[model samples]
Target: MNNRKYIMLDGKVIDKSITETEFVKADKNYLYDSFGKRYLDLRSGLWNTSLGYSDEIYFSVSKEFSRLMNKKLAYLDIHSFDCKLYDELSTNIISFVRNNMKKCIFTNSGSENTELALKIASAIYGKKLNVLAINNSYHGSFFGGMSVSGIDIDVNGRMGKAYEKVKFIDFPDDIISEESMLTWLEINLEQYDLFFIEPVLASAGVRIVSDNFVNEVLRLCKEKNTLTVFDEVATGFYRTGKPLFADRLKYKPDIICLSKGINNGISPFGSVCVSEGVLVRLEGKPIYHYSTQNGNLLSVSSANSVIKYYLKNGSLLEEKVGKIETQVKKVMKLYPNIVYRCVGAMLAIEVEKQDIMRLNTILKDLGILTYFYNQPTNGLTILPQFNINLDVLEKALRIILNKIS
Candidate 1:
């Protein structure tokens, strides 16, 4: 057994030393542990590896980094950067998300992106910082993010007290009438300066809100002059069969937060894309947030490659996600007792709490990886890579069904 003890894996139950022994290399859609056991990565490495491991993007990024090795610099002011490569990469990102969103602010992770968005909104509406977030939505794990997140399991004791200015509303449910949801929004519209939401509640077991509900919320926000922020960390970059889930919404949000699949899981990167109106609000003000690794050359290059790849191959990737959604629906039909919700390549199945643990163990034993969500109810969340082989996915589903059914 490995004797090293200064390591930790979040949400892991095994002893630290044992978990360390499982460390190994990853290639494509599989992970090989020290014992040479290959496991199918269904969670896509925390739902970030949309393009899978060891992809060409990684190789290209390596080459680019090598070329720029001597010139690599950190903590430089964004306003004074003169690197041509950096400019090209930034331009590519802005063009990739062309439309009302003309400006991009880079961050190192989804949590930071959320925090930045909040800060921008706060700056625009100083002293009027009342924020509204949906229940069951997860923004991130950082203090500011945890304050707005509905699922407090991760930050319960550690977060101290929730932000007093932030309020939570129940996420729209199928059981709730549209009239009721609209009424609630109308009542609370004038109280908040900003509204935050995840296009798809991925961490909350892939819960999807109806478009009507979202549109109405946006309309109310517009009327109240409250800025709306979409946490697209989990639903952006064609993960939802669209470039961004916000694209499907009739009413556009003022600010959009993106990460996770932004760089096809190749680098730790996140960005907040804002509309011209929102940008103008902060044009003369100093941005209150800054990180040492924000918009690093490596991350920028990887993001450029990932965005270029997606723009070129989006149609094929959409078809692949469509097939996976179809497969999930078919599986759901076979087991009426198991409730399921799916969108694009993401799926969530609800089961008994005990069954969640049992199925997770079985899936692990079968060399498949998945995430279990215990909040809002027990659920097995599945986020497979966009290009996952159908045969392998089918086999994994079969194994799950055989064991769960």
Candidate 2:
């Protein structure tokens, strides 16, 4: 066997011989490898393709790109050019998030959007760089994003020294009291300039924080002048049974970082939705961040199409997600040893530590793609498209249950 010529860096040393060939085609909620094996994409292409593999988003974006081919517009310098596409896209994005946020800044990835939010907070509160993040939560993989992330990833090497500025707090587990949490924040709140959160900790075993906890945290942050930034990169765009998980909270964040499902996974794009108060602070500030693909025409158009799609069919999507959640809960009841949690289309199933690898391999062999969490407890995360076929999901679930049992 000639050693595989490609040098792919996935941070894992898997047996290349057992790996399947490259995927040749992707239809709705499924992928076909070169050998013609069909696999249900339960992870929704890293939880970004809320509308599944093939949708009208592809057609709309292609049509727009064909009309405006090769139009390059950078975020910092686009003001000089008459970029009507940029303006139209920005307006559409603002409309989607404007109920809780006032302005939007585009980026190419979730990490960049998160990093930009941190920079904006720093710019607003100079000299107060302390940030509060929850343990076991994940924001992204970039420097700023990793700094805020509480996962045990190997980020403390030479490049990870920047994470020293971030202080992590324990996530409110079941036994922790609200009063205790409030007291802890009251004592330590003034020292931090920003508090980053994932409304539903999707990467952290799909843990959903209580509304009371979220409301109290926002209240304390307000009292101490600490800016709140919701990293909704994983939970936005109907992933959590709402347009944004923050919609369920009583308090609105100063900044909300969104990505993943914005363009239904058609493009790599992210955005930071800022409140009017934060925008005022950034109004006259000189540019501190720039990316070549920031507000790119194709990405913007795709994102616009996704938002419009959601606006039109949001109610139906939400209803379908509710049905899926009910099905998941019922299946979970069949196995007492198995523990699970779900929010809209996202689900996390926990099994014994020893069986983690075996279960993952079995699920993969059964033609289901899933994600695993980096936690002490073995957790498999599933985030299917909002409108995933219930029949397909039910079949996959039965297969998973049978293997685990």
Colliding pairs, model 1: none
Compared with the true structure, what per-residue lDDT tens digits does model 2 show for residues 79-123? 345577677777888777765687788888998987798789778
Note the Cα lDDT for every prediction shown. 0.78, 0.78
Clash number for each model: 0, 0
Per-candidate alpha-carbon RMSD to the true structure:
2.7, 2.7
360-396: candidate 1 lDDT, tens digit per residue:
8777877988887876888788888876787888788
Candidate 1 global TM-score: 0.91
TM-score of 2: 0.92
The alpha-carbon deviation from the true structure for residue 166 of candidate 2, after best TM-score superposition, in angstroms, is 1.4
